[model samples]
Target: MFRFLRSLVLPEAACEEANNSSRYENLFKKLDLNEDGRVDIAELHAGLKALGIPLGKDAEEKIFKTGDSNKDGQLDFEEFMQYLKDHEKKMKLAFKSLDKNNDGKIEASEIVQSLKILGINISEQQAEKILKSIDADGTMSVDWNEWRDHFLFNPATDIEEIIRYWKHSTVLDIGDSLTIPDEFTEEEKKSGQWWRQLLSGGVAGAVSRTGTAPLDRLKVMMQVHSSKSNKMNISSGLKQMVKEGGVRSLWRGNGVNVIKIAPETAIKFWAYEQYKKIFANEDGKIGTIERFVSGSLAGATAQTSIYPMEVLKTRLAVGKTGQYSGMFDCAKKIFKREGLKAFYKGYVPNILGIIPYAGIDLAVYEALKTAWLDHYASDSANPGVFVLLGCGTVSSTCGQLASYPLALIRTRMQAQALLEGAPQLNMVGLFQRIIANEGILGLYRGIGPNFMKVLPAVSISYVVYEKMKQNLGLA
Candidate 1:
């Protein structure tokens, strides 16, 4: 009778044990590519890639180092279980230490104190900014729900069961890394998550584009109206826009800009996945170079499919009050006057720009991420959110710098009309004219707003993406 009463109240342990059994079985099958019940670094990477989690080489090596307690250079079943249990305990303890009052939420002051405890000193303002992204309730504090949603949403492991692992022990690791292995353990695949990555990326793109629509429109305006005759600068242009219409005018092209996200992300991902397989060898994994090639081609294909939407977006964004009222209105008129081919006016330059932009962006981001892990991240597994944001902003800025001139030219061609008397300018002709008339500086028109949009845009997108993954249980 006593045991039955206890079991009724404390059923979570048995539930977690069952979950652990299944989770371990799935992970062992997937990570042990050779079916040897042990996971090597290469197989671990391959498995992670399949699960849609990306990681740096240095981070992967570190996980291996930490997990391989016996120093065998591989992780057996027992070793993996121990690693999970250890990390889960650390996470829960971290949360508990942050919640000094023993209340469910970690308040603004508590977060500040907790960061100091971890030796991560930041101003109160910076602390608030970082916490704002994870504060779901708008109560200015992070509750257990918010905390779990933000950091404990790994699909590879049953973080719910991991919570049980934590409840059994209140102790934690203060100096260890919290970076979870981002591999697709066999356990995650059973839930039919093959399509989760593409959907998540699509959602991220939509959120990012919509958030930055005003800046994107400003870019178009600066691109098309940077001449002395127009008397247009960023300040004057924004003032003119608000004068013509209210602040709502800023989002004119956002509708079509948002709609293309799904198909584009889906196609790009599908193409990229296929290309990865094609490039893979007997090991069924491809290197970064092969990944880059696959991504570039996939981007081009997706861009071509929705090229018309981009043209329409540009037109609506730059249109006068009477010219275009909405996305369909602009599209119908452009189709009627300029016909279908006009939608692809700057197709070549746009396509060419993708090569340098993506190449530089990926190369720089990966390089910086690995460097950060190698240098400053020796003690911890996770590099933290701030580091990821910094790397993204820096890499995006570099990419835009390399490809800005080409981007400027493409915008001009798209905004140009297809009238018979207008001079037809190929890319070379356009480059020559801009250099001769406006000098090389003309090619970098409107770069200020573009750069301004990068950091916040990337930061918001990443935060939202992680939250969504957790909320959707796809993390």
Candidate 2:
């Protein structure tokens, strides 16, 4: 808070002495750029900027609000000093909490243990990453001076506030649906915001899937039926579907697709948290590798649990009109004709796809976000909605590109039994056959339609999610 401001303003005025009025007066005069008796937000911003501290508009406003004791939109010297004293006390308490051993310094172990108490487990290495940011010197630890200096401009009032500031990210549902669900802060969970956010995301996904139902259906049809003998491009594919089943048939499988969002998201989120804990290193930290593993496992766990719905969706999408009445009817027919095992025909390829999809999606997203921050953070810490969506779309497309072959194979296997004269091939056999019969490009049969849906799906999802978040009081 303002405590760090005093240190930056008057470096030699650290002592709490009543006779230090001259030093305080000098500091106040320096900040009062207009030669007025008070300092306003503009002056404060200019002062911080002069010191090479680039703070966001929100942070600057927050400081003004906190220090303007009389709500006069400015801080007189007395008000400024009072705010600094109060902030100093809070900062000291926070530092003490992290300095668990009372050694007057915050180390990696201390950060790890402290965060663990708050249900945030981190390995010592990850803790070191945090320390390195705040530890001005190469000592790899934070003393009172370094801590105060690092947070001088940050308006976080407590340790939890500081952690929250660092941990929060703008999570956008712009990528492959199979990617891991967004994480919620402990505060969000306790305050019931987590469910609201999840609900918003769920509604967004449902609408997105519905809006792109025709394209999704076409993608499935091409993946299962397209061959060297039967070429299927987007224009021809759409015409065929309309001719065969009429316009309404394009939404055949959309019911189950929308219905699975809630449970799949819930299971993925729960499994992700559990897997992260399991894969954490001995120091209680999860690194890049651990996160990738956890996310992939979480996706697989969710996909496995709800895989029957997937098979049903593919069946319904490829089914002609009157083939199945609804989701229940589709399930009944699949169960009656092919037995329980039929629901998991393409399980291997589906699960295998999760690894490449989740890994590449996460890695690319992180890389893009990191690069964006490195380049643009000096101008603004918050990467606006457009930037986030762009990164997510690019990362998702990359992931889809890498995993589309497996996905196509899985779809073919799922529908093989239903297609007339189709061979019931296992995962590997299907791959071999596709390559041999249709050539290497055959593995990417439905990718055109799949890629075509990415932009529209993401745009619809983001717009709907934003509207829903506002309605839910989450924005």
Colliding pairs, model 2: 122-284, 122-285, 123-284, 123-285
Mark the regions of model 1 whose C-alpha exceeds 4 Å error after superposition: 1-190, 194-200, 418-422
lDDT of every predicted structure (CA atoms): 0.63, 0.78
lDDT of 2 by residue, 133-215 (tens): 66655698888867765675577677777765333233445325567556665645766878888888888888888999999
Best by lDDT: 2
Which candidate number would show the highest TM-score if scored against the true structure? 2
* Candidate 1 structure lDDT: 0.63
**Candidate 2 Cα misplacement greater than 4 A, ranges:** 1-171, 281-284, 380-384
- Provide TM-scores for the models: 0.61, 0.73
